[model samples]
Structures are given as structure tokens and as C-alpha cells.
Target chain A: MANDNGDDARILRLSEQDNVVVLIQSVPAGERLRLDGQELVMAAGLDLGHKLALRAVPAGETIVKYGAPIGSATADISFGAHVHTHNMKSEYIANYSEDDPYEAEDGS
Target chain B: MINSYLRQDGRKGIRNVVVVAYLVECGHHVARKIAQPFEDREEHDVHVIGFPGCFPNAYADRMMRALTTHPNVGAALLVSLGCESFDGQGLKAHVQASGRPGELMIIQRDGGTRSTVEAGRAWVEEALTTLQGTPRVDMKPNELVVGTICGGSDATSGLTANPAMGRAFDMLVDLGAACIFEETGELIGCEQYMADRAVTPELGQAIVDSVAKAHRHYHTLGHASISVGNAFGGLTTIEEKSMGAYAKSGSAPISGLLKPGDIPPKGGLYLLDMVPDGDVRFGFPSINDTEEIGELIACGAHVVMFSTGRGSVVGSAISPVIKVCANPETFELLWDDMDIDAGRILQGEASLEEVGKEIRNNVLAVAQGTLTNSEDLGHQEFCMKYKRFEPIGPECLPA
Candidate 1:
């Protein structure tokens, strides 16, 4: 029962405890979002293939993708503040952790 | 109903090919000349396959031997430049050992190009007549090995085409046929999940370690972004892309993990690690689609199931590639280029089982000698580059 206009928009649950829903299609600013059969006004524009917060998130919280924890957030993120590189960091070993002494010494 | 052209080795080939193989690129002209004589034959089975390098290496020798004696090949004419590092005589002997007729037409010793061409033509003509006389047999679906790969992927790849191939792979594996899915670089993040689905715990660890090896290989080489399409389609990290790419393997228990050129031990899900084991040189793992197909053939694949959202047109020298288009829009744009429209799954026009059934049917038909789009277009491109692979660890091959 998702609608693009001012009508009720259906929200999708990516995971059981995930406090977010993915915007299957684009949603304009000020449009009302129907989440868990409850209506919540959109705080901002949401693009397709992007996620939106289902509930208010605290500063330094976890962000998930594909129903798995991708990384944590740095600052207090609004219900839909585009959880991305600016907010989340990789849990996998990458360039961000390039300064470890063990890595530098192993030199493999 | 399943008609197959039987080869001399008692193996049935989907196609009977008069393989015109050049020992080295130097002898390519003579090989082409040999193939010209049988250009208009009823079987229409002239294919040009060769290695450009004249280097001595076990990998190269093994690859050439496999290609020359591939299932689709019924007869061969090896055109050598008379002084190359490739073991031309050994190739001929191997071909002869398989009971298929093979002749070494040395360009330097056979009076140069023109004479070699004529002599090559005579050789091919004789080989063809002998091959034509081989009896046709009935090939069963269980005896086939179908490998799948997805290149030029985009957003729709996972939702439509990849899952569609997974459904088909499930059907193929259930029928007692072997199925292979590869490109370890593409399968980065889902390693743990995939390994957990392995038939044995040891295989699961191997799957995880294989991706770890690939991550290290690509990271060290600084070409980690070879998966550019995923980023273009809005994937942020390698793990995200890996999660998506791993779906192509379906929900089947991975029977084994294999490196490039290693055939599946038995028919089940196999992961072919496309990245080189150490140091990661050789320019790029695969220059294009044909190189991937060449590697699949080297690993004993009779046919490959190619899934693509962006669409691909290349095929292999010894195997028929069944292109499965993942995007409905791409399929609409390139319908002729694709063999199966997996995009229909998204439109609700076709169920996952329907497309899966179609892919399985197409595999059987192709194995029975139906030419695919790549084959019809004469895309006989081949490339096998140099690389060193430490044998896959015991965990990877827990039989």
C-alpha cells in the first residue's frame, strides 16, 4: 500500500530488529511514510536503493544493510540521515586500518 | 530425443568440431588454411583455437592438451611453426591417443605457408571424413557440466538474473549434472555465509579462505575496483558487492572449491577462484568474456551459463555459453544476444522455476549440438595467461 504522493506509503522491514526501512522508490520531502502501519512525516528526500531510519537513532549507533550490521555511526543520525561513508565505517579490514603495527611489520 | 555426436574417446560431444589449432600464433595462417577446406561441410565444425605465446610451462601445456582433446572436438589439425616451445609432437600424440586423428603440419618443414595450407587441408579433409563416420549416441542430462558466470553486472543482476541462474543451477545439480560458479574476486563478502553452506565444514573454511586470498591478491595489485559495475549500481564496499555476487551460487551445498583449470571433482556446486594465487600479475585476470570461457573449458566445462544485467556476446572455443540476461530492459534491448530472458522473473511473467526450467532445457539442447548466439557469431576467442597457483589447501578439496 505504498504511494508516492501525500497518501500512505508502505514501509519495508529489512530485518526483524532493524530500526530502518529501505526506500524501494524515491520519496519527496514532506511526504508521509507509513511504517509498521503508523504514519510518520518524511524529514527529507529519500532516493531509491537508499535506507531510512524507522526510529530515532542515538549518536554512535550501528547501521545495517542487507539485514546485517555494516558499521557504526559517528554522530546522532536523524530518522533518515543517509547512512553512508560519512556516518559508517567498514568492519572488514581495509585502508582505514592500514596503520596497525602488525600489518606494517608483516609486510606481506 | 537427446541426440549427441559421439567422439572417438567414447565421450559424447554436443558439437562435432574439426578443431584447427595453431601450435603458436606463428602457425595461425596455416591453421586457418586447413580449416578453409571444410568450411562448407555438412557438420560445419571448423574452429580456430591457439595460444599466442611460445613459452614452455606446465599450465600452458596442460591447457593446450585439454583444449585440443575437449569434448566438442572430434578431430584436430595442429599447425606448428616448426620451432616453438610448445610440444607440438606431444599434442599430436595426445590427440592420436584419444583415438581422434591429429597431424602436425609444420610450416617450416612443410614448404612454408602455401604448401602447409594444402597439406593442412588434406589433413583436415581426412580427419573430417573419419570424424563424420563416428556414430551418434544418446547423451543424458546427468553427464553434462554446466558452469555459470556473471560479468557486466548492475543493480538488477542479483534480483533477477543471478537468482534465476541459481534456480537453474539447483535444477541442474539435482539432475546429477555438475555445476560450477566462479570469480572469487566477485565473491568477496559472502564468504562466511557461502562456506557455512558447504557440504563439509572444511569446504566452508576453504570458501572463506579463498575469498580472503582473492581480497589480498586484488588489494596488493591495487586493482580491487575491477568490480566497477557494482559501485555504479550503488554498492559502497567490496563486501556489499560480494554479498550480491554470491547469490549466483544458489542455496546448494558447495561440494568443492577449485582453482582455475581444475575440473570439478564430481557434480555439485564448485567455486572456481579466478584470481591468480600469488603476486597477481598477468595484466588483468580476464581481458574479457572469452578468457573466462577459455578458463571454464580448461576446467572441463562442456557449457557455461553466463548471467548478465549489462549483457555480453562472447562465447568459447570448445563450449557453448548460454547467456542469461538478468535485466528486463537489457533483454529488451539485446534479445537476440541472450538465450534466456531471466528478467521475466521480475515482471511476474515467468516464475523462478520457469526460467530455471528453460535454462536446464537449453543446456540439454546445447549439449545435443544446438549452437548458441556466440557460436553462431563465430566467437572463437581464446586466452590463457601465465600465473602460479599454490595448490588449493586441503580444506578447499575435502572430498
Candidate 2:
């Protein structure tokens, strides 16, 4: 079983070159945890398998994971904040979500 | 280490299956009814595979011919609705020429659905009886052809199941078995990494170009091949999902690039280009997981490995499918459907190498006739679609 408490939740830093870490369990927003001798609080509630910023990243900077550039940050992200679609975009292609109004066109 | 049967073409198979294939969508119901009785039979392996396209196509024709004559097949019963355009007789002749028993029943000429189903069922019954005489042969590990794919993937897929496949693939290659990794659309972010692993510089360039083509296809279609389930499972973008998907290929040097239905001449490791050639005008941008599995079987994969995080429980018609679960939580929910719990790595109970060895042992056991979960559950899922591709160039191969 996984621990859900902020300080006890496990996270994996995949590579030495990566700037994001993946949470092994869900952690709530406002829960404080320590990493690299710095105390940081979760910026938002996140579930298992979600990534979080390991350090501050500015807008348009590359977000590295698995030692590769997965995407670029869309805004400045502080340490321990959830890093996902709102803050990042892929370099190769655009994402198509079913909920996006721009993509859902009526077929005749 | 396998107790297999040798085909006239010299390929070996672990199962002597009787395939009842429908030439068009209209023939599907009758074909299914014909194949239904033997689905759960202990010794009889009768399954349905078909091309649903009514229009005649070279791609579909080739797929059907290759599949009907596949080594795992002992006999085939081709079903036709009597007017759609797939060369039913030509395919039957092709199968017979390849030294396999082939029979056709056209609904229009054979007294419609009721009579055709009755006749087809009778033919399948006799074929199964004849297949009982298929000679068993000793097959070595070097003769195995294995393929890998990841579907219904989530974050743990890359972390656990996919990388475990990578290690298993590496071990298979070292043991002189041919291994294939496909779905170039899922390899979007790691093109350069794949290119760098190619045995020859020319093959590397071809690898990169293929990924670029996939990039354009999805760009033109406005669909990134990422599913709603993937996003909900916490895959943030196509690139992120792709990075996870790429790990299934392991770290072996890529020996060649192949199109659908093209068997690898001699495979150390081969990258199968799943997207069709040319722009969006001629064909579809990408296909689903089950369709990709059909292509792998067409490429001569004796068995296939499928890794999943959100969970997929499909098995192919010709070969057994080994399902590796990525999420320990998902495993708890779908334990009866999975073969191996690769999620143990994510749960800190097992190392990747340990699971990789487990996968390798499972493959050998499966080759030696151990039933996978899907096989025991009778999940013989199969699908194929129409698509065009120019043959791969010589430069795309290692030799």
C-alpha cells in the first residue's frame, strides 16, 4: 500500500538530468514536504502517476523527464507544483482532448 | 525450447489453428457462427479473422493471403458473401499453394447464410480432424520471433512494464531470437534515440524519416494518437506518452525497418513502421492496438508481449499474447486477465531485471505450450484494415 501523507508519499526522480519527479501516490494541495533540504508545499492536489516540478522553471523553458525534453513549460513553475498540460506543451505535435471545443466538430 | 509444428515453408508454430475468415463485412455473422462451436474446445483451436472492406484492395488481399497461410494455421475456411470484391478463390488457391488446406463457401452460391454456415461448420470440423495429424517438431529458442506493444498505457507503463519488456527484448536478442517493436506514432519523441541504435547509418536515417512521416500524419489529422483514457491516466502530452511507449523496444541495435505483412529476413531487432506511407489523402493516420497486433502476427511474430497500465485484455488469433500489468493497483483489479505483474517494480517488490527474467522465462514456457491468461480465457481478438505502403528500400535493412 502507498502512503498518502505529503511527507510520506514516495516520488521518483527518473534521471539525473530530469527536472520533474513523478508521484507514486496522491498528495493534497497545501500539504508540506521536504526535498533537497528545502521545505515545499504542494501547489495543487494531484493523483498517482502525476509529475511535479523539482525546481523552479520559467515560461518557454524545456521540462526534462527521462533525460529528454518532453515539452516546454508554458509558465513559471515553482518547486513541488504539479507540472502538466496547463504549464507545458509538446514540441512535436498538438494534443487532442475530447473536451476541447476546438476539436469537437459535428459530423454530417 | 519448444514442442512446435513445422510448416512446409519451414516456419514453426506452437498452435495448429483453423481459421474461418470472412471476405467482407456481410459474411461476418455466418463466419462467427461457424467458428463459435470450437472456441472453447480443449484440442480444437478454431478462431475467426477477416477483412471487413467490401472493396477489393491489394493491401487487404496480401494480409489475408499471408494470414491464412501463416505457420500457426493448419487449415483455413474462407467465407464470402458472393459479391463484394475480395478475391476469395484466389486467396483459397494461395493458401493451398502454400501447402495448407483451404476451402471456400460463398453464401450466394452455397444456399445463403443458413446452408453456408452449416457447410462451413462441417468443413471446419473435418479440418480440425485432419489437423490432428500435424507432425510435432523440436524448436529451439533461436527460431522464435517475438514482438512487443503497449496499449492502454499510463505513467507506470514506462516506469515498469515497458522497460521490463526492454530488458526482456535485450535478452531475447542475445539468445538469437528475432524481436520486433512497432507503432511508430507512439515512438514520436524518441526518433533520434531509435536512429542512434540502428546498426547502419543508412538504417538510422530511415528510422528518423519514418518517425517524421508519422509526425506529419497526426499533425494533418489533428489527432495525436493519445486516447482519453491515457490523459485521464495522467499522461500529459503525446511526447510524454511516446517517451513511455518507446521503452518497449529495449536497447538492441535495430537491424531493419519493415512495412505491414513484410516478414523480417533475419531479425536481430526490427522497427515496424505502423503508419501508412504518403500523406493523409491515401490512407488512415494510425490504427488501434488490436489492428497493430494483427500486423505483428503477419510479420511472423510467434508470440507477442503487450504492456498496459490502464489495462488491455486482448489476445491474437494465431499466437498467444502475454499481458504485463504496469500498475499494481490495476493488477489487483484485473489479475485474472494478466499473465505477469510487472507492477511489482513500481511497488518496490521487484527489480526491472528480475521481472525481465521472469518475462523471458514466461516466453520460453509459452513457447513450450504453457497457456497465458488470455489463452486460457479464450481471447482470440484480431483486426486488420486497408492501408497502402511502398516496399521498404534495401538501405533500411542491416545487410
Per TM-score, the best of the predicted structures is 2
Residue B199 shift from truth in candidate 2, angstroms = 1.6
Across residues B129-151, which tens digit of lDDT does each residue of candidate 2 receive? 88888889999888888989999
What is the fnat value (0 to 1) for candidate 1?
A: 0.04
DockQ of 2: 0.19
Candidate 1 residue B250 C-alpha distance from true site, Å: 0.8
Among all windows of ten consecutive residues in candidate 1 chain B, which has the lowest summed lDDT?
Answer: B225-234
The local distance difference test score of model 1 is 0.71
What is the C-alpha lDDT profile of model 1 across B238-318, one tens digit per residue?
Answer: 555565566577667888887766767677888887766555556566667677778788777888988888887777777
TM-score for each prediction?
Answer: 0.82, 0.85
**Candidate 2 positional error at B173, Å:** 1.5
lDDT string, candidate 1, A1-108, tens digits: 443323233333434556655554557889876665456677667554455666667767766554445456666777645555555554554322222222212111
Checking candidate 2 for backbone clashes, the offending pairs are none
